[model samples]
Target: MMRSLLDHLLIVPIVLPLVVGGAMLLLGERRTRLKAGINVAATAALLATAVALLRRVNAGGVEVAVYLPANWPPPFGIALAADRLSAAMLVLTSIMALCSLVFAIARWHRAGVHFHPLFQFQLMGLNGAFLTADLFNLFVFFEVLLAASYGLLLHGSGPDRVKAGLHYIVVNLVGSSLFLIGVSMIYGVSGSLNMADVALRIAQMRDGEHLLLQAGAAILGVAFLLKAGAWPLNFWLPPAYAAASPPAAALFSVMTKMGIYVILRLSLLLFGDDAGASAGFGSHWLLLIGLITLSFGALGMLAAQNLPRLVGFSAIVSSGTLLAAAGFRSPAVTAGALFYLVNSTLALGAFYLLLELIERSRSYGADLLALTREAFGLDRLQVDDDDDADTGDAGVAIPAAMAFLGLAFVACALLLTGLPPMSGFVAKFVLLSSVLNPGGLTPDVGSGVPASAWVMTGLVIGSGLTGLIALARMGVRTFWAPSGRAVPRLRVIEVLPITALLALCVALTFQAGPAMRYFEAAAAALHAPHDYIRGVMAARQVGATAGVLP
Candidate 1:
C-alpha cells in the first residue's frame, strides 16, 4: 500500500494545480486573499512534491518511474513518467512558479480577474508537459499552458500589451496547428502516440515509411523551434515579453525553455544514434540555426534601448546556446547546457522583475524632460548637467537600499553575460571546455574537436562579450547617469524573490561540482534511453500481473 501511494505522487504535480485552479475559479475574484492563500499552499506543495520526486529518481538510479492513469497499459491509456531529466525540470518549474506567484502578490495579481486561477493552470500545464510520456498529452499540455499565457499576457491591459498579446496569440495558434498536423502524420504512420512505442515503430519502419516519418518529424521540429524562439521564428518573442507584466514576464522566461526541453527529449529519444539512418538527422540544421539565433540575440541586445526588450533578447541567446549544445549530441556538452539553462533562466527571470521596479523608480518627468530637450535641439550633455545640478540634497542617503539594488543589478548582469564568479561563467566554461576537449587529460588527437565545436566556442565567447557590453551600457544609464530620479521603494515581497533567485545562481556557482555531476548523469540517461523504455514497459507488466490493468 505504501509503495502504491508513493508511486501515485508522480501525478500530484499535475492534478493538484488543476483542482486548485478550478476551485479558485469558483471562488470568484473578490476573495483575493483566500485565493492567494490557496495558490501559496498549492505551489508550496508542488515544490515539495517536485523535490521528493527528484530525490526518488536520484536514489533509484537511471530507472524511470511510470504512472499509468486508470491502471491502463500504454499505447492505450495515458502515461506519466519521471526520470532524472523530467524531475529536474519539474523542480525548476516549481521554483519559478513559486517565486513568480509570490512576486505577483505584490500588485500584478490584482490587476486582472482570475489571475490566481490562470497562474495555477499555467503551473498545471508546465508540470504536465514535463511529466507526460506521450506526444498527444504533450500537445494537450502545450495548449493548456498557451491558453493560460494568453490570459496572463494581457493581465494588465495597455495598448502595447494588447497588441503584443494578439501577435503572440496568432503565432502560437499557427504553431498549434502545425503541432496537430505533425502529430496526426506521426500517428497515421506509426499508429502509436506513446513516445517509446513510436520510437520502436520508427526504428522498424520501411524505406517508404521513412519519408513520411521524416516529413512529420520535420514539421514537428518546426513547431518546437518556433516555441524555442529559434532565429527566424522568434521575432515575436521580444516585443511580447517586453510588454508583459513583470511577473508574467518572469514566468514567460521558462516558457521558451519548455520548447527547448521538448526538442531535446524528442531529438535524443526518437532520432538518436540507435535509430539507423536517422541518427544525427537534424543535427547540422540545429547547430546552424542555433548559431544564427545566437548572432541575432547578440545584435538585438546591442540595439535594445529598453531594459525589458534586452532581457527578451537574452532569452533568445539562452535558447540558441541550448539548441547548439544539444545538437552536439555529446553527454558532457548536454550536461553543461542543462546547467546553463537553469542559471540563465533564473537570472533572466529575476532581471525582468528588477527591470519593472527600476522603471517604476524613474520619475515621469524624466521622459518629458528628454522629449523637451530633443524637440528644442538641446545638447544631451547640458541636460545631464542640469539633472545632476539638483542632486546635492535630494533626501537622506539611503545608501543601503541603493547599494542593495545596485549590487543585485550587477549580479544579474554578471550572470546574464557569463562573467566570472557566477554560475553563468561556470556553465559556459564547462560547455566550452567539454566541446573543445571531450577527453580531459588524453585528448582525442585523432579526430580533434569538430569545426562546429570551434565555431560554437567562438559564438559563445562573442555573445557573452556582446551581452556584457550591452548590459554595462544599460547599467550605467540606469544606475550611474544622473537621472535625478528617486530610488524605487522596494517591497519585501518583490525584493525577496529577486534576491532569492540571484542567491540560487550564486549557490549553483559554488556547488557546480555536484550540480554538474547530476546534469551529466541525466544527460547520460537521456542518451541511452533504453532504461526509459524498459522502465515504462516494466510498469505495464506489473499492472498486468496484479490484474489492475486490462
Candidate 2:
C-alpha cells in the first residue's frame, strides 16, 4: 500500500499548486502576505515532492503515479503517469517555478489579480503537462499552462508587452490547435489517445496506416518544435520572453522545454528507431536542424545589443543544443541532453532573477546593460578596492552564493558552448564519442555512426565558436565593464532564490550519477516503446475484460 502510494507521487506536485492557487483566489490581492505565504509553501511542497520522487526513481525503476480521472477504467479514462524522466523534469520545473515565485514576491505590486495565483496556475499546467499519460490530457494541460502563461507574460500590460504577448499568444494558439487536430487524428486512427495504446497500434499498422501515422507524427513534431523554439518556427519566443516581466521571463525559459519534452517523449514512446527511418524523417534531420538553430541562436546572441534580447537568444541557443543532443539518436547523447536541459533551466532561472535585481537597482530601467553597469558600478573594465566587492561580483553578498551563481552561470555558458568539467561538456563528449566510434549508428556494426559523429563534432565546434565569441563579448560588457554607480545591497528574498538555483546547478554536477542513470532509463525506454505500449494496452484490455460477461 505504501509502495502504491509512492507510485502516485507524480500527481502531488501538480495538485498541490492547483489547490493552493484556488485557495489563494479567495484570499485575493488584499492579503498580499497571505498570498506570498501560500505561494512559497505550495512551491516548496511541490519541490519537496519532486525531490522525493527523484530519489525514489533513482533508487528503484520508473515511479508511476496513475490517477484515473473520474475513477473510470484505464482505457476509458485519463491517467496521470510519472516516470524517471518526467519526475526529473518535475524537479527542474519546480525549482524554476519556485525561484520565479520568490522573485515575484519581492516585486509584486498592485497588479489587479494577485500574481501568486497566476504563478500557481501556471505551475499546475506545467506539472500536469509533464505527468499526463493521455495525449488529449497533455493538450488540455498545455493549454492550461499556456493560458496562464499569457496572463503572466502580459502582467505589466504595456504596449511592447502587449505586442510581444500577442505574438506569443497567436503562435502558441496555432501550435495548440495543431496539437488538438493531431491528437484527434491520432485517436481516430488508433482508437486510443493513451500514449502506450497509440504506440502499440502504430506498431501494427499497415503501410497506408503507417503513412497516416507518419503524417500525424510530423504534425505533432512540428507543433512541439514550434513550442520548443526550433528554427523557422521559433520567431515569437525571443521577443515575447524578452518583453515579459523578469519572473515571467524566467517561467517562459522552461516553457520552451515543454515542447522539447513532448518531442522527446513522442520520439521515444511512439516513433522508436523504426519510425525515424520509416517515416522519412531521419534523426539526422533533427541533428542538422539543431546545428542550424544552434548556429542561428549563437549569431543572434552575438548580434543583440540589448540585455533581454541577448538572454532570449541564449535561450534559443540552449534549445538548439538540447535538440541536437536529442537528434543524435544515442542514449548517451539523450542522457547528456537531459543533464544540460536541467542545468540550463536552473542556471537561467538564476540569471533571470539576477536580471530582476539588476533592473530594480536602476529604479527599473529597460536598458539592461546600462542598468547592469549602474547597479554594479562597472563603467570601466578595471575595478578598484574602493569599489564594493559585492556589486562587482554580480550583487551577491553571500560569498558562497556569488561563487556558486557565477560558477553555475559559467558552467551553463560552457555547456551551452560545449565546454569541459560540465555535463554539457560530458554530453557533447559522449555524443561525439558515440558518433565517431568505429561502430556505426546501428548497435551491431555501428554503421552510419560516422556521419552522425561528424555532425556532432561540427555542431559542437560551431556552436562553441559562436557561443564563446558572443559570451565573451557579453561578459566583458555586462560583468567586467566599469560603471559610475555603487553596488547596492540585495534583499533576503531576492538573494534566496538565486542561491537556491545556483546550488541546484552545483548539486546537479555532484549528483550527476543519479541524473545520468535516470536519463539513460528514459532514453532506453524511448528507444524501445514496447514496455510502454504493453503496460497501457494490458491495462486497457484488463479493464475491458473485467466488464465483459464470462
Candidate 3:
C-alpha cells in the first residue's frame, strides 16, 4: 500500500500544475496576489515532487518507475515514466520555473492578464513533456507548451514583440505540422505510439519498413532540432526570446532544452545499437548542425549591441553546445553534457532576469545623445537594422546598486563563458575531458581519435572564447562606461531568485563529484536502455484501478 502510494507520486509534477492553473484561470486577473500565492504554493510543491522523484530514481539504481494514469497498460494508456534522465530534467525544470515565478512576482507577472494561469499551464506542459513516455503524448505536450509560450511571449505587447511573436508562432506551427506528420508515419509503420514499443518495432522491422522509419525519423528530427535552436532552423529564436518578458525569457531557456531532451530520447531509443540498419542514425547531422549553430551563435553574440539580444544568442550557443556534446554519443561525454545543461540553464535564467533589472539602469536619453552628437558630426553615425540601441551612457554611477550589478554580471559572464571558479567552467572541463579522453586523461595528440572529436574540441573552446569577448564588451558598456543612467532599485523578490540560481550553480560546482557520478550512471542507463525498456514495456496496472478504467 505504501509502495503504491509512493509510486503514484509520479503524477504529482504533471497534475499539480494542471489543477492549480485551471483554478487560477477561474479566479480571473483582478486578484493578482491571490493567484500569485497559489502559483507559489503549487510551484513549490512541484519542486518538492521533482526532488522526491529524483531521489527515488537515484536510490533505485538503474530503475524506471512508470505511472499508468488511466490504469491501463501501455501501448494503450497514458504512461509517464521516471528514470534518472527524466527525473533530472524534472528537477531542473521545476527549479527554473520556481525562480522565474518568484522573479515575475516583482513585476513581470502583471505584464498582461492571465499571467498566473498561463505560467502554471506552461509548467504543466513542460512537466508533461519531460515525463511522458508516449510519442503522441509528447506531441500533445509539445503543443501545450508551445500554445502557452505564444501567450507568454506576447504577454507584454510591443511593436518588436508583436512582430517577433508572429514569426515565433508561424515557425512553431510549421514545426508542429512536421511533428504531427512524423508521428503519423511512425505510428502507421510501427502501430504504437508508446516509445519503447516503437523502438521494439523499429528494431524488428523489415528493410522496407526501415526506409519509412528512417524518413519519419528524419522529419521528426528537424522539428526537434529547430526547437533546440540549431543553425538555419533557429533564426526565429533570438528575436523572439529577446522580445519576451524577463521571467518568460528565463523559462524559455529550459523550453529550448526540451527539444534537445526529446531528440536525445527518441534518437537513442528508436535508433540505438539494437536497431541494426538504423544504428547511429542522424549522429553526424546532429554533430554538424551543432557546430554550425555554435559558430552562428558566437558570431551573433559578437555583433549584438544590447543585453537582451546578446543573451538570446547566448541561448543559441548553449543549445549548440548541448547538441554537439550529445552528438558525440559517448556516455562519458553525455554525463558532461548533462552537467552542462543544468549549470548553463541556471546561468541563462539568471542572466535573463538580470537583463530586466540592468535595463532599468540604462538612460534612454543616452541613445538620443549619441545620435545628436553624430548628427552634429562630433561622433560617427552608424546603426545596424538588427542591432538595438547601445547600453553605453555617461554619468555618475551609484555605489551600492552598481556593486550588485557588477558582481551578478560577472557571475553570469563567468558561467556563460565557461570561465573559472564557477559551474560553467566545471561543465566545460567535464565535456572537453570526456571528448578528448574517453578512456584515460591524456591522449597521444591526434593519434587514434576521430577528426570530429578534434573539431568539437575546437568549437567548444572557440565559442567560449567568443562568448567571453562578447560578454566582456557588453559588461564594460553596461557597467563601466560613463553613465547618465540612474541606479535601479533592487527588489528582494527580483534579487533573491537570481541569487538563488547562481548559488545553485555554486552548489553544483561544490557537489560536482557526486553530480558527475550520478550523471555517469544516467549516461550508462541511457546508452544501454535495457532497464528503461523493461520499465516501460513491463509496466503493470494497479489492482483496484484496472477494472475502473477498462
Candidate 4:
C-alpha cells in the first residue's frame, strides 16, 4: 500500500497542475478569490508532493523512480522518472509558482481574463518538462510551456509586452520547429524515443549511425541553447523579460533553467565517457560557449539602464556559469554548480520582484533628470528650486517603507554580485574551490587544472566584479541621489513575497554545509546513469513478468 501510494505521488506533480488549469478555465473570471484559492491550494499540494518525493528517494537509498503511464514497456509507452535533479527542479518550480501566484493576487491576477488558468498551465508544462523520461515527451512539454508563456507574457496587455511577446513567440516557434526535426532525425536513426533506450542503442550503433546521431544531437542542442539564453542566440530574452509584468517575470526566471536542465541531463547521460566514439563530444564547445555567454552577460549588465533588464542579464550569467561548470564533467564542480543554480535563481527572482517596487518609488522627473545629467552635462547636486534643495547633512530620517526597500535592494545586490556573507558568495567560493582542488587537499598535482577552467574562474570573478559595480551605481542613483521623489506606498502582499525569497537566500547561507552535501549527492547520481537506466528499465520488466504470471 505504501509503495503504491509513493508510486502515485511521482505523477501528482505533473498531473495536479494540469487538472487544476483545465478546471480554472471553466471558472468564471468574476470568481477571482475562488480561483486564487484553488490555484494556491494546488500549488501548495504540488510543493508538498515534491518534498515528499525527494525525501522518499533520499531515505530509500534509491537514485531513481520510474512511473509507467499505462504499465506498458518503455520503448512503446510513456515514462515519467524522478531523480534527485528532477526533484530539486520540481521543488524549485513549485516554490517560485506559489510565491509568484500570491504576489499576483495583490493586483496582477486581475490584469487579464485568464491569468489564473494560464499560470496553472505554465506550471503544468514546467513540471512535465522536468519529469518526462522520453525525448518526444520533453518536446511536448516544451510546447506546452511555450504556448502558455505566450499568453502570460501578454497578460497585462501593454504595447511593450505585446511587441516583445511577438518577438519571443516567433523565436521560440522557430526553435520548436528545429526541436521536432532533431527529435525526428534521432528517432529515424535509433528507432527509439525513450532516452534510456536511445542511450543504450547509441552505444551499439555502427560508425555510419554515429555520424547521423551526432548531427541530430547537434540540431537538438541548438534548440536547447537558444532556450538557455546562450550569448548570440539570446538577444530576445532581456527585452522580453524586462517588458513582462512582475509576477510573470519572476516565473520566467525558471524557464531558461529548463533548457539548462535538459542539456545537462542529456549531455551527461548520452555522451559520457561510456558513449564510445561520442564520448566528450561537445563538452569543450559547451565550455567555450559558456565562457563567451558569461562575458556577454557581464557586458549586458554594465550596459543596462534599468533594473529589469539588469536582472534578465543576471539570469544569463547564471546560465553561463552552470553550463561552463557542467562542461568540466567533474562531480564536485557539478555539485557546486547545482548549488549556485538554486542560489542564483532565487536571488534573481527576488531582485525582479523588488525592482518593480523600487522603480515605482522613483520621482516623476527621475528619467528627465538622468537624461539632462547625461546629455547636458548638468550636475546632479545642483538644486533647481528651494523645495528641491540638497541638505548635504546626511542625517535625514528615512521612511519605514523606504528603509525596508533599501535594505532589500542591498541584499539583492549582494546576492547577485556573489559578494561575501551570502549564499551567492558561498556558492561561487565552492565552485571555484572545487575547480582548483577537485581532490580536496590531495590535489591532482600532476596535470593541474585546465587553462579553460582557469579562464572560467576568471570569468566568474570578473562577472561578479562587473555586477558589483553596476548594482552599486544603480543603488546610489536610486537610493542616495536627490530625486525629490516620495517613498512609494507598498502593500503587505507585495512585500511579503520578496522578503520570503531573501529569507530563503539567508537560510541557504547559514545551512550551506548540508545544502552542499545534498547537491554533491545529486551530482554524483547524475554522473552515474547506469542506476537510472536500470531502475527505469526494471519497472517495465517487472510489469512484463507480472503479466506473464497472471
Candidate 5:
C-alpha cells in the first residue's frame, strides 16, 4: 500500500489545488473565512506532499518516477515525471505558494471576490507546469497559469494595476501566440510532442530535418525569453511586478522562474550534447541575453526608488543569472546554478513579502515627502556608523515592530548583495567556482576556463557590488533617514511568513553541502538524461489492461 501510494504522489500537487479551487467557486464571497481556511489547508497539504516527492526523488534509487494519470503509455498519454529537477521545482513552488497564500490571508485576500479560487488555480498551473512530461500539457499549463495571473494581477483593481495589468496581458497574449506557433512547428518537425520522444527522435533525425527543428526551437525560445523578462522585451516585467499586491508579487518571482525552468528543461533534454547537429543550440543567445539583462537589472535597481520596483529588478537579475549558468552547459556549473536558483527565489519572495510590512511606515505619501526634502537639500545627513544612526541619539527606544522590519530588511540586503554568511554568498561562490573549474574542484592551468566564464565571473561579482550599493543606500534611507516614521502595524501572521521564508534561506547556508550534492546529481542527470527518456518512454499504467510493454 505504501509503495502504491508513493508511486502516485506526482498527481497530488496538481490535483489537490485544482479540486479545492473549483470547490471555492461554489462558495460565495460572504464565506470568506471558509474560503480562506480551505485555500490555506490545501496549500499546506500541497507543500507537504511536494516535500515528500522531493525526498523520494532524492533517494538515488529513483532515477525518474513516472506517473500516468490515464491508462496509457508515454507519447500517447499524459505523463507526470518526478526527477530531482522537477521535484525541487515542485517543492519551491509549493513553498512560495503557501507563504504567499498565508500572507494574503491577513489582508490581500479581501481585495477581490475570486482571489481565493484564482490563487489555488495558479498553484495548480505552476505544479502542473513543473511535472508534465510533454509539450502539449506544458502549453496547457502555461495557459492555465497565465490566465489565472491575468485575474490575480488586477485583483486589487487600482489605477496602477489596471494600467500595468493591461500591458502584462497584451505581452503575454503575444507570447502565447508565439508559443502555439512554436509548438505546431516542433510537432510538425518531430511528429511527437512528448519531450523525451522528441529528443530521442532528434538524436536520430536526418540532416534535412535539423534546420526545421532548430527554427522551431528558436521561436519557442523567444516566447520563453519574453516571459522570463530578458532585455529588450523586459520593460513590462518591473512595472507589472511592482504594481501587483505583495503576495501576488512574491508569487510572480517564481512565475518568472517558470519561464527559465522550461528553457533549462528543453535546452538540456532536447538539445544537450546528445542532439547531433543541434547540440548546444541557442546557448550563445542565452549567455548573451543573460549578461545584457543582468546589467539592465543592476541599472534598474540603481534607479528604482520604490521598494517593489527594486525587488522586481532583482527578480530579473535572478532570471539572468540562471540563464547564463544554463548557457555554460557544464554539469558542475549547472549544479551550482540550481542551488543558487533556489536561494535567490526564496530571498526574492521573502523580500517582496517584507516590502508590504515595511511600507506601512511610509504611509500618506511619506516617501514623496522624503524625496522632496532631499530635492531641497533638507534630507538628514547620511548615517555611516551605528552610533551615528539617523533614527536616534542613544536615548530613543525602537519599537519591536520597527526592529523586526529593520532586521528583515538587513537580511534581504545581505542575501541580495551576496554578502558573507548568507546563502546568497554561498550560492555565488559555488556557482563561480564551478564555472572556473567546469569539470571538477581543481582547475587545469593548460586549459583554463572559457573567456565567457571569466566575463560571467566578473559580472557576478560586479552585480553583487551593484546590489550592495543600491540595497544599502535604500536600506539606510528607509531605516535610518526616515527618523520619525511610524512603527508599522504588523500582525504575527504577516511577520511569521517573512521570518519563515528568511529562515529557510539561513538553513540553506548551513546545509549547503547536501544541497550542492543533490544539485550536482541533478545536473549530471540533465546533461546525460538517458534515465529521463527511459522513464518517460517506458512508463506503464498502474494496474492497466493494455498491450504497452517496456
Candidate 6:
C-alpha cells in the first residue's frame, strides 16, 4: 500500500498545482499573498517529490504508477508512468515554475492581476505533459498549457505582445489540430493509446503493417517538430517568445523542451530499433535535420540585434544540439541530451529574466548606431530654430542592475558555448565520449561505430563554432561592450528569482555525478522499454491468475 502511495507521486506533481491554482482563482483575485504562499508551497513539495523519485529510480530503474480509471485494466484505462527521465523533467518544470512565479510576484501585484492562478495552471499542464501515459491525455495536458500560455503571453495589452500572441495562438492551434489528427490515425491503427501497449503492438506488426505505422509516426513527428521549432516550421517562435512578458518568456522556454521530450520518447521507443534496421528512416535523417536546425538557428542568432530576440534564437540552437544527440540514439547520447536540456532550460530562463531588466533600463532597442557627424573635439552644436529639441536627459542609471545583467549574460554565453564548469560542457563531453568510445555497448547489426563517431564529432565541432560566433556577437554587445547606456534597475522580486536560478545552474554543474546518474538511469530505462511494459503487464497477469485461482 505504501509502495502504491509512492507510485502516485508521478501524478501528484501535476494535480497539486491544478488544485492550488483552482483554489487561488476562486479567492476572487484579492488574496495575492495567500495565492503566493500556496503556489510556492506546492512547487516546493513538487520539487521534493521529483528529486525523491529521480533518486529512487536511479538506484533501481524506471518507476511505474498505474492509475486505473475506476480500477480498470490498461488499453481501456489511463495510467501515469514516471521513470528517472519523467521525474527529472518534473523537477525542471517545478524549478522553472517556482522561479518564474517568484519573479512575477511584483509584476502581478502592481498589475493587480491573479498571476499565480494562471502560472500554476501552466505548471499543471507542463507536469501533466511530462507524466501522461496516454496520447489523448497528452493532448489534454498540452491544451491546458497552451490556453494558459496564450493568456500569459498577451497579459499586457502592449502592441508587440498582442501581435506576438496572435501568431503564437494561430500556430499552436494548427499544431494542436495536426497532433490530434496524428493521434486519431495512431488509434485507428493500434487500437490502444497507451505508450507501452503501442510499443508492444508495433513490435509485433508485420512488415506491411509497419508502413502504416511509419506514416503515423511521421505525422506525429511533424506535429512535435512544429512545437520544437524544427528548421522549417519554427518561424513564429522567435517573435512570439521575444515579445512575451519576461516571466512568461521564461516559462515559454520549457514549452519547446516538452516538444523535444515527446519526440525523443516516441522516436526511441517506437522507431529506434526497427526503423534503424529495416526502413532507412533512421538516426541518419534526424542527424542531418538537427545539423540544419543548428546552422539555421546560429544564423538567426547572428542576425538578431535585440537581446530578447537573440535569446529566442539561441533556444533554437540548443534544441538543435539536443536533437542531434537524439539522432545518435546511443545511451551516452541520451544521457547527454537530458543533461543539456536541463542546462539550457535553466540558463535560458535566467537569461530571459535578465533581458527584461536590460531592455527596461537601456530603452528596449538601443543598438550601436553609426556615429553620425563626427565633429572636432571642440565642436558644439548651436541650437537653430529648425533644430530638433533633443536634450541631455540621458536615462535612469542602476549600476547594481547592470552588474547583475552582465553576470546573467556571461552565464548564458557559457551555457550556449558549452563552456567548462557548466552542465552544457559536461553534456557535450558525455555525448562525445559515448559516440567516440561506445566501450562495451553492442552496436546494432550493420551500424558502423565509425560512422556514428564521425557524425557525433561533426555535431560537436559545429556546436563549438556556432557557439563561438553567437557568443562573440550577442554576449559582447549585451554585457562586455563599454557602452554608457543606462540599463534598468533590478526589482527586488525579479533579482531574487534570477539569483535563485543562477545558483541552481551553478549547483547542477558542481553535482554532475548525481545528475548524470539520474540521466543514465532514465536513458537506460528509455533504451529498454520492455522493462516498462513488463513491469505493468506482469503485475496485471499475476492479478488475473490470483483472481482465477481464488
Question: How badly does each model clash, as a count of residue pairs?
Answer: 0, 14, 6, 0, 0, 2
- lDDT agreement of model 6 with the native: 0.73
lDDT of 5: 0.86
Best by lDDT: 5
**Positional deviation of 343 in candidate 1, in angstroms?**
0.5
Angstrom error at residue 133, model 3: 0.8
lDDT (10s digit) by residue, model 1, range 1-550? 1246777899999999999999999997789999999999999999999999999999855458888876776667788999989999999888888889889888778877899999999999999999998999999999999999999999867677789999999999999999999999989988999898787777788877877887888899999899999989999999999878888889988889999999999989988877876677788888899999998999999999878788899999999999999888888889889999999999988998787666655545443223222323332222344455655757435445567778988999999889999999999999898888776535687876789989999999999999999999988987888545565556799889999999899999999999998898899999888888767655653435632311
In order of appearance, the predictions have TM-scores of 0.93, 0.86, 0.92, 0.93, 0.94, 0.86
Worst 10 residues of 2 by lDDT: 541-550
Candidates ranked by TM-score: 5, 4, 1, 3, 6, 2
lDDT of each: 0.85, 0.71, 0.85, 0.85, 0.86, 0.73
Question: Per-residue lDDT tens digits of candidate 5, residues 348-448?
Answer: 99998898677667745643233223323232232245534545545666678889999999899889878889999999999999989987878888896
The local lDDT score (0 to 100) that residue 151 gets in candidate 1 is 97
Runs of candidate 1 with Cα error greater than 4 angstroms are 1-3, 365-398, 541-543, 546-550
Q: Candidate 1 at 525: error in angstroms?
A: 0.6
lDDT of 3 by residue, 21-48 (tens): 8988889678999999999999999999
Error of 2 at 2 (Å): 11
Model 6 misplaced stretches (Cα beyond 4 Å): 1-4, 108-114, 272-282, 364-398, 440-456, 479-484, 539-550
Stretches of candidate 2 exceeding 4 Å from the true structure: 1-8, 61-65, 109-112, 273-282, 359-412, 420-423, 438-449, 539-550
lDDT of 1 at 48: 96
Q: How far is candidate 4 from the true structure (C-alpha RMSD, Å)?
A: 4.8
